[model samples]
Target: MDIKEYIVIAIAINAGKTILGIYNSDVDLKLDQSPLTLADRKSHYIIKNKISQTKLPILSKEGRKVSYQHRRIWSKYWLVDPLDGTKEFIKKNGEFTVNIALIENSKPVMGVVYSPVLDILYVGAEELSAFRIKQASELLKYLTLINDWRNYAESLPLLSTINIFRIVVSRSHLTKETLEFINSIRDQHSEIELISKGSSLKLCLIAEGYADIYPRFAPTMEWDTATGHAIINATEGKVCQADENNKESLLNPKFIAGAFNVDEKRINNHGR
Candidate 1:
């Protein structure tokens, strides 16, 4: 990990601590019909404050919205979702995560997704390989061994075998389109198994090879998938949009992710 990656990880760990604090308390409702908590607000403040040291503009869910008119002028920026999966958080399912990514030229160059409940941190950067730090070690301990953290971490694509078509979908939320997409693939894979997970972990599962694909047919903001995209792309997996012709859009549509050679035929065929 470099200096930027180190800072992002530290911030995520700190933010995760804040989120856990709020998780133990009552949550409130947002105007957008989603759950909100002090953790969300506090995490946003903490990340924004820390990332400001890099002197990069941030496009966070809780911060001022930056339209493409202005956002396009920047060569780089910070994309963050202080706390993802508020619904899961409200349900206390321990599937929520805090996501942070460094975006350069519309692509996530560095990513970190931290789950406070699970005490798992997944990180990936441009020159650095993706790695996961689990409950066995303290996250900040890497601060002292930034260049050698890989020595204490587990590399990505955790599995080398692709046994069957395994899929990851939202446990608390699913869409008709997603179901249809799954059925479309069932023709090619009879032993397809479906796993339910919340937050950006779905993408992380695909990155580490615990699952093969996560198709998102419902709506999702840029921040929701940016970090996941980075981690997935760091390995052999990827997150893509519906428009095959336009690859620059950060907003997600119906998309599919899998290994490098995983047939994207289904997504291209089902493009809406």
Candidate 2:
């Protein structure tokens, strides 16, 4: 099996399953006021332990804080968010995901995202493009199923003739800037559909062609978007920084992500 299909995909699945195991644990607030749980720690350790076999440095949101000075020198590393959407997980909404990405030269070359509750997996790489698998939770213990899974997996940007202009936004984080962005989109497209999703699923919707665009004007860390960005790129889509000035920062600038064949004029005008 390919590394992305076997290692990255498996690691995400394992971490996601571990998270689901502790789904009902008590939730505490971090210094940033984000929810934290035993599941987050368990998933982080599980991914850290397994992915260490690759011998590449790891940058995980849940892991130790690696100084930018230390991280700047590494040409290649594994970027992980062991448990994304802590709020959604706490809400039992099943929109949380385990995100893993391979970064080289400051760009994501490969990625895997697994949603434990939904039992879906999305994987992508420069070489392999992108794919989405249903019932991916069942592949956790069965390595032999990799080939079968790949065969059955749906290629990303699945729809070729979508009519309505769909915009996906964070369920828990609808900011004033986001609303303004939506209103701007409404001015351009007569038929607009708004989708409320949690976590990286917003990006996944664009990758799978379920949504046309995802405008994230709220704050988000690099790890939160890295996996989804890679998948979208694999499908010939864009995850562009809203501000070109902050392109070098570790914290992602406000951004807009869109599916392949989306109106470039829309993105070019708004994703500045």
Candidate 3:
């Protein structure tokens, strides 16, 4: 399907999440060991079915189990993380999001992140462009574009002589390796502040220049960060290799760095 059509589907599915998330408060809560809720299931179903119409095989967190044997053969496909922040959803923290990404040759080319509670949609493509759309008051009016959004981004001051950096960590899952990595940074940087956030919004904070770096040392599947990774890349930011020992093994499967003030060429090299 075309980009506009995909966006429409994303917004529609996000609206469904808003309805269900609100409704779920009155119903009995079923908390899985890993924070699964009815709203997550509902959103996942809506997005999965809607994207299925595009005729592309989907590898989704809530959909059918397709083996990598089949997935490895496809040139292009969809990667989805419907209801990304299930813990945040259950907590009513309003930080959860729905993520949809198009992966071409194991790299994300396009992505859409919709936060139902916030009524914000961030869309982008590696070849095309990126934009943030906010929902209008009139139900039929659709999304109103925010003009000169890049100007707002450029207005932010750059990092100069700061010895310490702000680091964003996962709220639900914290690992010892992640802590050790943070401590390692703390040894060099004077003061390290750890901010806890859920879902892809962590990447947004870095893209918006609120945070300096975000490192995920634990295991994370591709769909979990694809959309946010795309956004970080588009915003002239670098999600680079953290390993100091091996430069070639730059793209850390263990960690990701969202340095917003960095150059695009540097970030592009990280992608390689």
Candidate 4:
């Protein structure tokens, strides 16, 4: 689908999230420990229904689980986390997001993440590249008249070698493994800075060039990182495998990183 179509779908799904989040806040907002919520369920339904029009198979957090016996046969599918960051949503911090990613051969090739509360959308595809689009403030006047407003793309700025390295981490799910990884890097890179954020926005920061790296050591399903990973890859970054022996070392073709102009040897050495 084209970017315009994806934007419309994203906006519609985000509207559902906003409505449910507002309506459910007064009801005690029970947490399932797993972070399930009415907003998550509702948003999942809305997004699933819309994407169902294409008759594509989907592996969603809220949807029925097809056995791996059957799913392993498919070459392409949609991986979705209808509502990411249930903790932030319940806290009313507006850091949650809606994620949809197209996975092919165990890798996400396209992704769209929409934050309704913030009115920000991040879309990426292998061929089209990745971009962040936001609505114009003045366009709010035509909200009723115009179904979709024009969006301005946010581009990544150039980085200076001496600039501080900003690392993005999860606010609610920090783990010992993650800490060790951070410590290992900090020992070598003294200027490293940490920015804790909720949900898939961690990857968005890297895509937008706001952060240099994001190390996720805790358990996360494929859907959780697929969308953001695709966007990061589009921006000349990659998500490679973390070294089994050293948490700080990134394993090639597994760990993800954005595109860098440096030689492969330097990139591999830097991660180690």
Candidate 5:
């Protein structure tokens, strides 16, 4: 059995369910001043327990800290954000997700991002390509049909696209640089739409071809972008540093994600 078809998908879905079960729990502040809730812990442990069977080391947002020196030695491992977009989850906006990715040699190779509230599941890998499953809560009921995932699962970056140049940005973390980047795009295109979204959905939008570009100039850890980066990578999209020549780091640098190449001028010129 494929690990993605069984273990990965099952764990994401179950974790999403666990998150929803305790939706209305109290929120606490983490050391970083970010919000934490019961759902985050519940989902983290659920994924931790299941993924542990894989025997690969895990680097999770909520798990015990693993230093970079130790992590640098790992050629491959699981990267997870059990509850992405806690703010959205708290707002009950149905825009949050549970993110999991496989990192090989510091690059994401496979990924799964599930939005439990929306019953949407997205899975992508070098071997399996990329797929978006709607009403994904019912996925378990048809486990045998996974080999034929293409029959029901929608392949990413859907064919139909709007004429408008859409730019998806984080609802909470739109930095001044991001706004200037959007303005730069507007300068070139007469019709431009700015989209406000939370969590990894911004990258997912690019993978789905709903948005033409996403400029992230704000702060984000590796776990925050790895899953989405894998999905974008699987779709033949590019997620790279603004300079385009700089290598990716643990804390991702200012970057642009898009299905097509974004002009280097726009990336380097923004809010610098």
Candidate 6:
């Protein structure tokens, strides 16, 4: 791994420390009726401190949202959601994650998703394919020997054991539109499996071939799915905005990740 990648992993691991600490604490409410603990704030601070050194403007869920006029002028920027699946964290389900993505021309060019409770990390870039470390040892082993972590990552779309038309969906925020999509698919395919997953890890699971697709009909911000979009796109997959035909805007939009052929296209990483 390059020094920049190593630094990002280190920052994510340090932020995980804060996340786990807050997970064990009493949970409460944040904005939009969501939960926020010290983890969110600490992770945001740690990631911003390290990533800011790259001199790219960062857009994070915790930080103030930048005006479109200001952000559109940039050719590149950092996108992050310091703590994803806070509800799962509050539930102590060990499904929350840290997400970071690099946006070039409003498209995710690189991404990293770390699950502290699972001790796993998923990374992908324009220059490299997507990969997942089954167990990252809380990033300790990576800190000790970066080469080992880099060498051990399993490539995306791991061989599937079953020939099932699997569909992975959000565990907490399932919508009627999503259900309708699933029902429609079941008519064409005989063997259908619905997998429940939380956080951006839902996208990683699809990249790993655990699920065939992730069709999210509910709303999502760019930060929430940019890293996942990058990782999946690296695997020759697509994460598109289903609402607009042009799909040029990167604001909130409906997202569906898989090998779907759609008129509106937002090509990411150009198949790597």
In order, candidate lDDTs are 0.78, 0.81, 0.62, 0.65, 0.79, 0.75
Descending-TM-score candidate ranking: 2, 1, 5, 6, 4, 3
Candidate 1 backbone collisions, by pair: none
lDDT (10s digit) by residue, model 2, range 139-255: 555647556777868999797576888889999999988887788668677799899999888899999989988998888888888889889989998877633211346677778
Query: Highest TM-score among the candidates is held by which one?
Result: 2
User: TM-score for model 4?
Assistant: 0.78
- How do these models rank on lDDT, best leading? 2, 5, 1, 6, 4, 3
Write the residue-wise lDDT of candidate 5 on 1-272 in tens digits. Answer: 27454688889999998887666444433333233466788899999999999989988889847776777778888999999997777666778899999988767889899998788988888887888989877866676655755677898868745688788999988888778767765777879989999999999998887887788889887788888888988888777572211123556677888764445455444434
- Residue 114, candidate 1: Cα error in Å is 0.5
lDDT of each residue in 1-272, candidate 3, tens digit only: 25543544445455445544554565433444233555556766777667766787677777636665556677777777877877776666777778887777766667777777776666666654555655522322543343333332232223446545677888888888778766765665578778899888787667656677777776666667877776666666667643321112213376556666645453343232
Model 1 misplacement above 4 A: 26-35, 141-143, 160-162, 242-250, 264-272
42-84: candidate 6 lDDT, tens digit per residue:
8999999999888888888899456767766778888889999
The 10-residue segment of model 2 with minimum total lDDT is: 27-36
Show model 4 residue runs off by greater than 4 Å: 1-12, 15-24, 30-36, 136-151, 156-162, 242-272
- Higher-scoring candidate on TM-score, 1 or 2: 2
Best by lDDT: 2
- For candidate 5, list the clashing residue pairs, or say none: 157-208
In angstroms, give how far residue 252 of model 5 lies from its true place: 1.5
Could you tell me how far off, in angstroms, the CA of residue 164 lies in candidate 2 after the best superposition? 1.0
Candidate 3 similarity to native, TM-score: 0.75
How close is each model in CA RMSD to the real structure? 3.4, 3.2, 6.0, 5.6, 3.8, 4.8
TM-score computed on alpha carbons, candidate 6: 0.86
Roughly what TM-score does model 5 have, to 2 decimal places?
A: 0.88
Which window of 10 residues has the lowest lDDT sum in candidate 1? 242-251
